[model samples]
Target: MAWSDLLAGFAFFLMIEGLLPFVRPDAWRRGISILSEMQDGQLRRTGFIIVVAGLALLYLVRA
Candidate 1:
């Protein structure tokens, strides 16, 4: 894989990883509970949104 792609994936993984320790456990559980309540269609739509945002940012900075 290209270094840029590798770095971008690492950055996004770090973003998600960083959130866990910073947020309170109770708050995190509540958030996950809310997420679990979402319909499959809604969850799929959310997944697409996240993918698009990541790709757009990656394309903007590609060298």
Candidate 2:
């Protein structure tokens, strides 16, 4: 894969993350941002879900 593809993926992730504060200002504000707003329990659950989903998607694509 080309470096441009990796850069493009990184840029897309940034654009989505940047828009989260804009779109959900209450749940994610300026000083107390999205990253800081997480509870440890919820964070763990969400992280698990994301990892599972990504792995499942990759499996489906490859299989």
Candidate 3:
């Protein structure tokens, strides 16, 4: 992909990452607190799942 494509993707990612906190700060805070209480292995597994899902989506979208 081009540099502009990469930048645009990053911008969209930032916008999405901000949505929950902007729309419902309380719920976002609660979610963050819940994540903070999770065990390391659980968090790692969650992260791995998210990464794999993202990659799968990107592959499907770009294919």
Candidate 4:
């Protein structure tokens, strides 16, 4: 993949990640609080699932 493609993807990620806090700051704070209360094991599992889901989506789109 090209550097431009990588940069574009990172920019899109930033835009998406910024949306929730921009649109609903209270909800975003609540979500962060909940995440902070999670146990390490639970957080790790959740992160793993998210990563796998993203990879699967990328594979489907690219393939």
Clashes of 3: 0
- Candidate 2 segments whose C-alpha is farther than 4 A from its true place: 30-42, 58-63
Q: Model 3 clash pairs?
A: none
Q: Across residues 13-57, which tens digit of lDDT does each residue of candidate 1 receive?
A: 999877875877778888889999999999999999999998899
**TM-score of each prediction:** 0.71, 0.56, 0.97, 0.98
The lDDT values for all models are 0.89, 0.82, 1.00, 0.99
> For candidate 4, what is the lDDT?
0.99
Residue 61 in candidate 2 has what lDDT?
73
- Per-residue CA lDDT of model 2 for 1-63, tens digit only, reads 699987997898899889868888776666466657889997899889999997899689769
User: Candidate 3, 10: how far from true, in Å?
Assistant: 0.5
Error of 1 at 56 (Å): 0.3
Clashing pairs in 2: none
- RMSD (CA, Å), candidate 2 to true, equals 3.7
Ranking by TM-score: 4, 3, 1, 2
lDDT of 1 at 10: 89
